[model samples]
Target: MTKIIDGKAVAKKVNDQTAEAVTELVAQGVQPGIAVIIVGEDPASQIYVRNKNRKALKLGMHSVVRQLPVTTTQEELLAIIAEYNADRSIHGILVQSPLPKQINEPLITRAIDPKKDVDGFHPENVGKLITNYPGHYPVANTPRGIMTMLKEYNVELAGKTAVVIGRSTIVGKPMAALLTNANATVTLAHSRTRHLKAVAKTADILVVATGITHLINGADIKPGATVIDVGMDRDENGKLTGDVDFDSAQDVAGLITPVPGGVGPMTIATLMQTTVELAKWSDAK
Candidate 1:
């Protein structure tokens, strides 16, 4: 029987631990705090911000949502980030993606203090990840969350053949780095790769993050492989789906994650976890 990776259950476990940590930190007079800045009124971004805020509060941490106008300039955003970087109370700072065309996204990412970079997109943090640096530093939550899930399921990583089919900063690059750090021989593939499915079939673990819906099917997956799909896309009927065809891929894969209940929940949960860790690290300094 193919085991479905229950991300919700694992996320609940993480959230529970985070709630306890928050209580302990409160007793120590240190509250984990996160400040999320959303540039525009993009419905999806607004929803994501709201969810993060609610989760932080529910976990007994301080949460702030800074809503900025669509016309907010790059300089204006950098100023806000600077304010948070110096604020002792805020442990994490996240600027939501899809910024206005006039804003330089990379500049905003660089502006956040490395210690408080919850999204972990800053060059310093990315370098730490690539170098597999020692000590604690935040990582990109989505891929970090996937790693958490993999550990929870006891999926073997050392010496395994892993393939990650996305190269974005958010998921692909970090994920491949992580797998490599875990001793997995990883292949990072993208849309342009020739014979993509053939490359996928050789993996003991396959992560599909390309946005194209149902891009990976049964034939593409190795039997008994662990398949992680990171795509949340719309099908022809306007329904939520992933890059891998769950219906077909499930039958061939040994382990798989569902679209709604899988990687989505873990991302927010891990963000909350990272916030608490940041607070603890800050207090130690």
Candidate 2:
């Protein structure tokens, strides 16, 4: 029988640990704090920010949300980031994505202080992750959460084969690097790859992050492989779905993560966990 990976349960465990850490930090006169900056009225981004803020507060940490108007200029945004960078109380700083076209996204990412780059998009942090550098640096939460779920389920990584089906900085690249660091042979595939299904079938572990809904089905998966779906997409019925067709994939795979309940909760929980770590690291410095 195939076993389902319970991401929600794993996330709860992470949140519980984070809460305890926060309490300990508070007792030591260090309250872990995060500042999230959202630059537009995008419905999805607003919902994400609200959820993040609510979770942080619930975890007994300090949370700040800075909502900027859609017409805000790049210079204006940089100034706000500088303000947060100088704020000793803020341990983690995140600027929500999909900023207005006039804003230079990469430049904005570079502007945030490396220590406070909780999203781990900054080149400095990314370099650390890619190099498997020995240090406490924030990593992209979604992929990091997946790693946590893998560990919670006792999924072995050393000497395994992993195929990640997206190349975006947020999930794919970091994920491949992480698996590589864990001694898993990783293939970072993308839209242009030939014989994609064949390539996918060779992996002992697979992570599908491409936004295309139901892109991978049972035939594309190796039998008994562990499949992690990182896509959040709408199906024909306008309902939430993932890159892998869960129903079929589950029948063939030994381990699988379901949409809506799989990777989503873990991402937010890992974000909170990273914030606490950033605070702890800052305190030590």
For residues 1-285, could you state the per-residue lDDT of candidate 2 as single tens digits? Answer: 789999899999999999999999999999999999999899999999999999999999999999999999999999999999999889999999999999999999999999999999999999999999996899999999999999988999999999999999999999999999999999999999999999999999999999999999999999999999999999989999999999899999999999999999999999999999999999543
Name the TM-score of candidate 1.
Answer: 0.99
After best superposition, candidate 2 residue 272: deviation in angstroms?
Answer: 0.3
lDDT of 1 at 111: 94
Task: For residue 18, give model 2's deviation from the true position in Å.
Answer: 0.3
lDDT measured at residue 193 in model 2 versus the true structure, 0 to 100: 97
**Taking the candidates one at a time, how many backbone clashes does each contain?**
0, 0
- Candidate 2 residue runs with Cα over 4 Å from true position: 283-285
* lDDT digits (tens) for residues 10-115 of candidate 1: 9999999999999999999999999999998999999999999999999999999999999998889999999999988899999999999999989898999999
Task: Please identify model 1 stretches exceeding 4 Å from their true place.
Answer: 283-285
- Candidate 1 global CA lDDT score: 0.95
